[model samples]
Target chain A: MTTTQDRQSAGVEITPLTAPAQRTANTAFRGLSITAASLILVTLAAVATFLLVEAWPAITDASGELADKVSWIRPDEGQSLIEIAGYLIFGTVLISAIALLIATPLSIGIALFISHYAPRKLASGLGYLIDLLAAIPSVVYGLWGAIVLIPVLQPFYQWLADYLGWIPLFAPADDGTVSNTGRVALSAGIVLAIMVIPIITAVTREVFLQTPKLHEEAALAMGATRWEMVRMAVFPFGRSGIIGATMLGLGRALGETMAVYMILSVGLTYSFQILNAANHNTIASYIAGQFPEANSQGVSALIALGLALFVITLLVNMLARWIVSRRSEFSGAN
Target chain B: MSKRIDVNNLNVYYGGFLAVEDVSLSIEAKSVTAFIGPSGCGKSTFLRTLNRMHEVIPGARVEGEVLMDGVNLYDPQVDPVAVRRHVGMVFQRPNPFPTMSIEENVLAGVKLNSKRMSKSDSQDLVESSLRGANLWEEVKDRLDKPGSSLSGGQQQRLCIARAIAIKPDVLLMDEPCSALDPISTLAIEDLIQELKSEYTIVIVTHNMQQAARVSEKTAFFNIAGTGKPGKLIEMDDTTTIFSAPAEKATEDYISGRFG
Candidate 1:
């Protein structure tokens, strides 16, 4: 009461609800924050527009003068830009798919081991070690894959072709031999798998750690063994999170360039013999290897290939969001 | 299926600190027993020791004998997991597995162990368990919906159904209705009255009225000060404890004269 009377005596009045406040630190921070956020969207739109404008002629003018000069893309057959993109899309997807299949289960195992099995004193240290794998440069991985990993895998590839030659995937090329050099799609995919494990493991470890305590107790109180309890509560709770993490890894693998280009013995073969040098090549590596020697038309074709990769990555991201969101709505804690 | 419990020289510890010290008590089979105490008195801790649930927390251990039907649950040959199976538990909050449908939630105790059940047998079991918890009428049609879609009261009852589905000999409740409304508490109290005829029911509660209303026997626990272990102070019939407690501290706590 004294304060109110003092305020009235001092001729102070409450501000109206609609009255605007004077400029303050809050307004400045909010302005800067919104600008930074919107800048990302604006930059994304600008890049997409630029790619679309630059790649239009190469994509539309299939038999024009520029498309004629866009050699090294089936020069004898005169394949259009869309056809070449479609061909490269297969290799990009095949490599990332292999990476996803190998990385997803390994990441899940490492995450669970870190989150549930490791002792409290050692778990944090193991987690930091896993995250450190992501910090290694891709070029270093490329060098290691080419120099050290290839010789170790060459005998193994030869053994697979010798023992499992009847299977079409391990069957030799039409020239009648496997890659004694081990610079095959299988090795490139394995290298990509090693590179993306940290990404998937990081997201999945945090999700597994966030499994609700009450739910875990509820399962354990039911006499569930430790693994059973994890299967019952932790796995279901982290399912959508696992899917999202795998998609992130897949996106990273799809756009990877230096390691794949450095390690791959680039050749196009439709037989899908993964243990051979003459196999499909990813769009990123194709562009990376060819960009320096490319003309104006060749550059546009490469940008168009990049646009295809961007579309594929966008689709995978959308699919991840759809699955995660749909799962949360259907059965997650409403 | 109810069985009596005999606890002798029970001491619960978290790491090196004793939480509940040297308690001895016998609970009658087929009746409701309530443990009442001030906050941090370890009533809930002692309750967890009954089913070996406290060991889920690392370094939490108990030194004592918890005998159910003349068998020592703490014996080296006995598995804690088997003990929990025979002694079911319900927590304060209603925690039906959110990812499961109502029917699946009821059968989780059996299914999560990977035991096989025929389709018809599981259906019958679901009906009987939900009926046993008095929730069949409300949720009969939507057993396919997620367990989390229910109201708080309904979810608590679903947890009760889940607990009873395993056909345990004893049921341990740790402040099961503390997070519920008065009407829901009454509903649970009435359910407890119904359940005590079939299973040995031990509950820890803060509300004296709830203890008086639902339990036949009451035990009072107290702590002298912070950092001191909680001890069981008195045990008697509910009427005797409320109206004429033998211990002065019990009388003070019952009569609202507590410090």
Candidate 2:
């Protein structure tokens, strides 16, 4: 028999092993992580493959300069990928800007009432009611714009031309009917704003509700009135979150296809007035309308337009995420 | 300046539920009065009522009068904003506004409420308030840093500075040291002692030792059980309550029995 002192000096290692239960749990977690990661990779690959195949014709050699593949200078009518790319880029930016103009203030007001001012028992109910607006299908919105929204806006566009026509943005035709003659950029913008309002308001209200209680309390303790406290505490704290929410709405507006397609009639001619809805064409609407009638080369051009819209929205959302991440530090009591 | 608060049979309610039942107490001018009790015992509720903050919570209602310097705080014509302007509160957690710089946080009260203050006067008030809270030296060089960047102890001091910058006659503190380290607690305790020379101070605290350390007078509160209203069991000189005779409940609470 070995003495305890002899065993201690023997330099043999005895491993106090991890329990089998823990080892099995670890193995399960490792397997899950690998599986989840591969799923994401596979989905990304599928999207990339789709975009590359669809966009190949636009980049094919048919132009004078390599760089001309991305330019709108040469509208070959049927085979110009570069020209289609430029139009989609312009449409995405124009739609996003117009939608943001209307959505920002509307969303902030809706969020304010839902998060801070509305009666306690009614706040959530009212919020849900508003969110129901977002759930209506996009096609329904397109139909509504064509029948109701366009007709209602017709008189306003005439009034805008009569009174505010001095301004370049309103200097379009006085007749604002929804016929092919009346479809314009303004109608597409209004449709996009209405479509995005619920998303932005719902997101912003949730963000504002998550503001730390103590910060509001501190503002109250300082004798700031409800509105004053909101102006100082709530607005400052919620600014970046609101910006992110608005950008998300902007992304939705950029990709909005049905409403803009149904409401706007692109006559292949560009003009200055935003109210010239009959002549306006957005990236999504242009692609949707032209794709079915398009030859193989035209289909490629439209797909390339779709790619440009995709890239624009992607860039905006990434910028929004960066802003939102910077804002997370403000959520704490500190 | 010295000012007194007379709380006359004050009752607080959240809708139909009674929170604090019939608390009547007088806070002497220019002294620190500690309201000592266990968790959810209405000490904070009672403190909030003094500043009209109970009304800030939806459906919260107060009955009876809180007369500060002879004016009833609950009078219909009286503005709650005006009442809060005169009576500033610091909460249990240190909450410095994240958007504001350290100096701006200190001056938030005056900047938001006051119609005007001379540029020099505003600067002087910020410096003096920070000095009063004993945080001036530590933060003077970094006044432009965000208030959230401060250490926990420094943030609490910054809140104290914010409360003082408004120049309120009454300063209400709800568990101001509960979240701080002992060293920070001692610092706040020292500041409270100094503050009582100029402002009427009412503090709600769970630490009996803290009550014993800082206050001239102590109000002991107890709640029998869940759903039971909290009651003020005893109010007396700190020395008498801790060392001498009082209600048995007060003694039990002080001696570390079930509170």
Query: Pick by lDDT: which candidate is best?
Result: 1
Worst 10 residues of 1 chain B by lDDT: B109-118
Per residue, candidate 2 scores C-alpha lDDT tens digits across B15-99 of 9999999999999989999999888899999899998888879999989999988999999999999888999999999999998
Going through the candidates in order, their DockQ values are 0.70, 0.61
Tally clashes: model 2. 7
Give the Cα-based TM-score of candidate 2 against the true structure: 0.90
Residue-wise C-alpha lDDT for candidate 1, range A161-182, written one tens digit per residue: 8899889878876666788889
Q: How does candidate 2 score on lDDT?
A: 0.83
Q: List the residue pairs that clash in candidate 1.
A: none
Q: What is the TM-score of chain A in candidate 2?
A: 0.82
For model 1, how does the per-residue alpha-carbon lDDT over B119-196 read when each residue is reduced to its tens digit?
999999999999999899999999998999988989999999999999999999999998999888888899999999
Best by TM-score: 1
